[model samples]
Target: MSPAAGFARTLRAEWTKFRTVRGWVLGTVVAALLVPLLAAVSAAGSHASCDRNGVETACPEPPLGPDGHAVRDKFFFVHRTLDGDGSITVRLTSMSGIITYPPPDHDEIVPGLVPWAKAGVIVKASMEPGSSYAAVMVTGEHGVRMQHDYTGDVAGRPGGAPRWLRLTRAGETLTGYESADGRQWAEVAVVRLPDLPAEVEIGMFAASPGDLTVKQADLGGLIEQMRFTETTAVFDQVKVEGAAPGAWRHTDVSPTPGTNPGEVHHPGSAVESGGTFTVVGNGDIAPVGTDGGMAVELTLTGVLFALVVVVVVAVLFVTAEYRRGLVRVTLAASPRRGRVLAAKALVIGGVVFAAGLAASAVAMPVGKHLLRGNGNHVLPVPALTEVRVIAGVAALLAVSAVLALALGTLFRRSAAAVVTALALILLPHVLATASVLPVELSLWLLRVTPAAAFAVQQSIPEYPQVLDFYVPQGGYYPLPPWAGLGVLCCYAAFALALAVVRLKRRDA
Candidate 1:
């Protein structure tokens, strides 16, 4: 055969060999079907919901302020004080909030607020002395920014002081604390108000402004039960002489990152009783809808498809020998063991490359289409950089294919080779993410692992050490995007070399 003809013959043999294997056919079918199915299921199912059970009602939009230009929306829950005793309880939009406290004189004693963005601790109050003291705690990026002794006029508060509001940027958070007398401190209120132009009011509200009869008495009695215990506090300032000052209830708030901006300012579950217009809070909270499922589903589907491809390729390569007892027959034909091995390597490598190309061509657009229509379709407009990402996926498939071939050659046992390939691909990623190992040490291992090879798809620049999150050690390897992919390609090359060497030395 001519060189081109010889390559064509090898390709033909591979196609014929794989076609006869039922497992290869089934595995490919499953891969093609499963990816789309998972994507569809994710789109249709509930990623998350604003599940406050019953402590509050959604607020409606009010008029925009003089300077406010609809930066974000806020939700609020309101309650009337039928008696001089009531407590308020509620959670953040998604563990996102900045809490401000009043001076002890306001009866906001032992003031506390829980984060509504993610799972976080309830920051209780502590204080020092000054005029109109404030304690602020923020949960997000720049965590607890101003959570110190805040002793100044309420004007010094966040939107200005003395008002002390918690603020957040994306997931970053800041906390500010203030106090007069610098001793006892009272939580004024936790603010979910975004720094953006929009305004939002969420959570429960209650009022205990003391009994109508006690309006003549001290404000302390009216401000006694100013705590959130069961439902969200809708601004209740009532008090009973004997209760624990106020109640504190805990609820899970890691889910609701915020609400759909398109759905804001609708109607009743729309307007606030506080009479303030609701606005969008944080537009930056990620994984839209606060549902962690988008990433989870995507990851699972990709991994499943990759595994199916690997298994099918391994089976195709191994079963060919089983059907013809090719080991013995080929050995007889070649007499010299090395020649038989060379033919197998040439044949299998071609098959794996072709299969990888076919699988990748099918995966990309299909996966993206399956993901469309769901709000999770973040990359609606593809960028030039996306071409690199797509190419990375294809490269990953090709490398995986070649690795599978090498594993099959190394062990000559389909199951054993698949397991080893999986370990090689998955374990290192899990370890790297854990970050338990020192960066230098872990990165060294990452340099060698097939998992790190995929790092080439990373388009973001890695921060250099000293200014970056980590410093590099001597000889420690962490490749840049292209470099990382190169490392992976090198591993695949080395494995292929080993396969060739063994094929030359071993029996069929």
Candidate 2:
């Protein structure tokens, strides 16, 4: 027979063998059904309603991102209007706060501010959540940082005594500086806020990121409660050199009082006490919990669980033939062992890809509908992004199926192949996302292992313009979407090559 004719015959034989197995067919159906079912269940239960002292109330309209998640932008502002380009210089004397945890009913007095707790000088275009702005601030323990919009942070001094901070604005560019004396300064960051108004609010602001406490609701849903804490910053020699208009005005933009009423306490009628002014406030200007709304974009979370079924079926597809001594028949018929293995890989990969694609296409829309039906918000993404996520998921499962089949061929045992496949493709993902390992090690695992394929389904992206948790746990990928998927494809290809070599050399 011709080489092409032999390959065609091998392909036909493998397809017939795969179809003849009822368990493998059922497993594929189960994988397709389970992903959408789990996604719906998860979405339906993840609704977050506002609660005050354990009493559910009307949730005020949450500040949501493109994907529906509660965002933090509310903070106390003590500002003076600057009519033109200029600078504000102040000495941060001290920062201290009280953090109270619930249920445990205990208070931990922090000597300094908490991480993400900020006291700084800000130049804001408006007091909107997603508006453009630049700030030079001191965080709790993370030291001095220059932050802008909401997402970007530039570190300065790591940790030390209070520092003298200055923000100079020229036209559209804003430069932040840290100084020892009021004279000598070290430039920390320079950022440009385009289309800035001729007049902007420039002043001292203090905000403490609300304490996030995770709890289980009665409905088997996850609840994230944000408890507000008061943050105080003592500023001395508060001086602004620009077109200033009169006295400073204080504005408190805290969220509706739930557990704690947010407030801003300014220097008393005594004004500057010995050239020092104090400001105290509650509420956060950082991104808050998504309140289960983020669950919609994470439709792929169910993929990990569904993939186990795929791996088992894939391994059994090859190894069952070995156990029944049917492989000898298959090899004897085709006589080209490499072609036989290739045919099996192709059949398994194609089946998984089609099943996965159908599951994801149904899951995304169904998940979104379930989330909204449960009174939860769903964040919108571009059509292209949605298409990529669905397509990527299908590709991920197909590649993983081939990998499992390759392992089965090499091992000639179903259990070993399934375990090895799981270890290579799933364990690293769990460890990385769970944050059990150090970040460096976790990142390395995703970078080098088949688990990197998970990046293909990641829909949320890191924005330097918004401040939020950017980690694997938060749905951020270590590698670019396609690049990460490419890693898994490479591994699958290598495994198949090895399997072909072993199959050719070993007796069936």
* Model 1 Cα lDDT, one tens digit per residue, 1-508: 4755655554565566566778665665555455445545554552322334454443322222212111111222222211121222222222222222334433333322232221111121111011111123223222322221111112222221111122222211223233332344434433221232211111222111110111212422112121221112221121212123233222222122233322232211213334331211211111111111222223223544554565456544654574567756545544544333444445544444454445444555555554543333322212444456555655665566667767676677777777777778656655664544555566776777887765644432332110112212111236765677676677767776787687667656
lDDT of 2: 0.78
Residue 70 C-alpha lDDT in model 1: 15
Q: State how far residue 153 of model 2 sits from its true place (Å).
A: 0.9
Clash counts for all predictions: 101, 6
Candidate 2 at residue 298, lDDT? 75
Quote the RMSD, in angstroms, for model 2: 5.3
* Poorly placed runs, candidate 2 (over 4 Å): 1-29, 52-55, 61-70, 101-110, 159-161, 195-199, 210-228, 241-244, 255-275, 289-293, 320-336, 377-392, 413-494
Output the lDDT of residue 460, model 2: 57
TM-score per candidate: 0.45, 0.77
Which has the greatest lDDT? 2
Give the distance in Å from residue 17's predicted Cα in candidate 2 to where it truly belongs: 6.6
Cα RMSD (Å) per model? Answer: 17.3, 5.3
Worst 10 residues of 1 by lDDT: 205-214
